[model samples]
Target: MLRYVIDVVEMLDTPKTSGASLAEFLRSQGAENAEIMVKTIEGEEGLSTDFVRVFIPGSRGKSSGGSAPTLGIIGRLGGAGARPERIGFVSDGDGCAAALSAAAKLLNMSAQGDVLPGDVIITTHVTGWAPTEPHDPVPFMGSPVDMETMNDFEVEAEMDAIVSIDTTKGNRTINHRGIAISPTVKSGYILRPSEDLVSVTETVTGVNAVVFPLATQDITPYGNDLHHVNSILQPAVATDAPVVGVAITTAVPVAGCATGASHATDIELASRFAIETAKYFGAGQISFYDADQFAHLVSLYGEATHLQTLGRTK
Candidate 1:
């Protein structure tokens, strides 16, 4: 059995959804004995609010009762304009789907806390991969390479929520760019240098938006990439945290490959790696963002700042 901790932050005004509701949602889905707590302060500088704490049990198989894990939730309310700009929740499970389910439910409930119509909901998941074996080089032939499934997990968010995710997994080599000509194309040929480009790209074609981390360093230092980047983004992506994207400029690379050394000759030494970077950088918490909503936030804040400056001058 795995343990999970969930933290919920309320960013909007009005009686938004509470952590208790989210816990209840999970319970309805066959989750057992979710613990809940609420923190409220009156006449606070911000709006009056409540913080709910909840704990949820991990998914294994249903059993009668054996000290099931508890879910915790905390809610806080402040002044009208004091609503939290973002809310977050974290859950752990045996596989990805279980973790994702908890996160998706929390975000969906939070987004609809006030139960307002037309409220936008978005969701996405980021996957991290650690190479368990050395990289194997294969000739660029039109042949299908068998991939051993290291780990497979899924997180289900609201059906309508838009998802933007970044996956941290081992890299694959493909023969598409260019090839050199020689008397014996297979034996005497020059191989072009492979570029290590890591950036957020589209995944899942057209389901909201998905970001693929494809830069070399993003997967470099083996353990570093996985530990730092994925660790930070995991909760946010899994729980549908509100933000644009994580700023990973100052993150350092770590040592260790997912796959071992000397396993495959074709695989590059620095080709695939995963590592843990840091706990927190900015705001002390990693931020997750929906592609469209984040853009709207930027525009709204930009205009608000301009108006405030103009009013001061007038």
Candidate 2:
């Protein structure tokens, strides 16, 4: 619901906020099982900020020997805003908002005795101010920390699959409202769209789901002097699990650091989609890809997981 989106935005729009207090806020919302931790790593750019980890252990609890698969919902963003230059929360923060809102909804559902079958871990940082970087189409939000640090904090081994949500407004390739789902990415190959995810999208939106195309460079590690479609695929490089991008798109390209660009309704739609996906994933009703098929592909063409790393030095 839009109320959830608005609630998260109001909480994180403070002058100097951190994940510690934000975690407390979620606790007050009945996410008593949620865990929060902050990580800070300095990059060469001399910019540093806290990267937050919020883990909401499901009813079966992965650590408790739950057979159900664990689903990781990562809020991918550069920063919420750029401080004085960009006063309020920017478009990039949509991922953080959507992830939190979905967590809140799930927790509320659990409170009502409809807990998910598997574990759901939600992670993202709450940086009120972040740096901006220049790109080909438009300026992008530069992370306060580095990409390696982010992946280290966000991607966990317990996660069997990942839904990397990011604001993809800075591209003209996808000119639509609401959100779009990228094809499933596992190991290193960009495989066909996951039929399960596509069905979930259609059932939720009541419209044929849109797929945003991905280039090879898009899935590569950041800071390689290569252009990325967006950071939606960044998590793929850090995990062996299958990763899919949940894009918050618009009809026209929008800068990630642009202020006054966040739309609550659009965010609500994306959040709901994430929540639904988590539900199915935890229930084992959906699979990122058929394990048998993926293994066959690997046998035919060899391993593509190396693409998930920095690759061999020349």
Candidate 3:
């Protein structure tokens, strides 16, 4: 995990990194059995970015004819770098780095006999010249595309549950210098943390679980007039399947575009956690949320799908 993190960070700490380059790197790392796709998407004001999607199939996973659940691992980030403004890989790139590292590790495992039981879909964007935006405590690395465009590309229909990993250090939410997770979010409802997921976190980190603070606005669609902690939970707005956020955090607020602030060990920790989660989640050993309770919530109250949209005009 650490090796992959170091390699990815080194590769991405450039002004020429693109999705195609990262896809090639994965292929070189024994991804022959996986289905990988790279698309260059252009959004807002001629801004363009590369998106990479990798599907690592499980023996009994949906990619085949089996019925095992598929887990989506998304390296949710605004951009990997600020380019001319900031010269190196920013803190925001941690999510993409950790996620791609997990994909690489899984490919290595597949090269051996450690195949999982379910399919895993991993996606993230690569952008080196993203812009910056002013925020409260620190500035954010703005993406080349909007949240909706990211959702369209990264959020796959085959994903039964999603683990959205993003750098959550730009806010004063969780004051930890490691990884934290958000509760299971589905259909606009912020459910409790999955005990199974929490256990996985504990097993990987060898420490108590740290839950990232979240608000309703955080899970809502971006572009709305609301204060989101960050885009960590934005994937929830794009899928009915339960989504959990794995946040790379810091004890103090840090700008998303801040250079020389990324910790490979922490990113490696998050990568290990995601890989373990995929192993357990694909085997049907755990769930993202309680199905019965979620049904009851829907039965007790109507759908909160409205919260997923931008809502009616003011």
Candidate 4:
């Protein structure tokens, strides 16, 4: 499985690449339903990139009158291949690499007769030359498209729950080797961390689950001069579904676009964790958040969905 991830990283780390190559790679691995769409965005340094989406239908299949929920596993990254300044895949691409790895693993598993109960849809964009931005502690990777553009394509209606994975090494908050999970966010409300996911993480890694400390501002929309821990929680602003971040962390602060910084072992751990989560989550063995409790909170506090939008003034 790790070899699959390495293969993906090497393939995506090229200068002239698109989602077509990724789609082909996954197809070669038996992902027959994979699709690719490239949109020309003016902001991506004039680079037209591709958005790749791979659907591994459950045993019942979504359109086949199946009752199982669909899980959206999004690989959040500034770019897969940061070119020119950075010659190959950057540290920020860990999320995309891990997501693709999980997709490949799941497809292989299904081919080998280990199918999940619900569908798993993985989405992410590929760009070779993404811009960079300056930050306080370290330089960060900038996307060719804005956050709004990313949210528009990554967040979809069919996803009952979402796991947004990003490279979180530029901050000093988390100091771990493998990865950390964030508190579940739904419709702008941050709920108690899901113990079920923690147990799943522990079971997968054989170690205690590490949760990244999150604040109210963390789940809000990006920009507005407000500081974000990272883009890990950005998907929460675009959907009412429960969203959790799977952060690829490090022991110290590392710039997002830094080359020669990706650790394959750490990425493998994150990919395996995602695979485990997908397996149990689709089987109804995991709960992202209690819907009844969230409804009760909504009733008590009114609509916090306003957090999902940019602030407006009269």
CA lDDT of every candidate: 0.21, 0.84, 0.91, 0.84
Q: Which lDDT tens digits does candidate 3 get at residues 226-268?
A: 9899998998999999999999999999999999999999999
lDDT of 2 by residue, 1-314 (tens): 67778888887777666677766667666756666567765666676666667676677767668788899999999888788678888889999889888877777777667778888888887787688888768888988788888898889998899999899989879989888999999889899999999988888778999999999989989877777988999999988899999999999889998988888887887888888888889888898988998999999999987777776666
Q: Best candidate per TM-score, number? A: 3
lDDT of 4 at 31: 45
> What are the root-mean-square deviations of the candidates from the true structure over C-alphas?
23.3, 1.6, 0.9, 1.7
Estimate, for each residue in 104-195, the C-alpha lDDT of model 4 and write its tens digit.
88888877778888888888888888887888689888888888988888899999999888899998889987889998999888898899
- Each candidate structure's TM-score, on Cα atoms with residue i matched to residue i, is 0.21, 0.95, 0.98, 0.95
Please state the error at residue 126 of candidate 1 in Å.
24
Highest lDDT scorer: 3
For model 3, how big is the CA root-mean-square deviation? 0.9
* TM-score of candidate 3 versus the correct structure, residues matched by position: 0.98
- Overall local distance difference test of candidate 4: 0.84
Candidate 4 displacement at residue 313 in angstroms: 3.7
Question: On residues 174-201, what C-alpha lDDT tens digit does candidate 1 reach at each position?
Answer: 1211111011000011112111111111
Give lDDT for model 2: 0.84
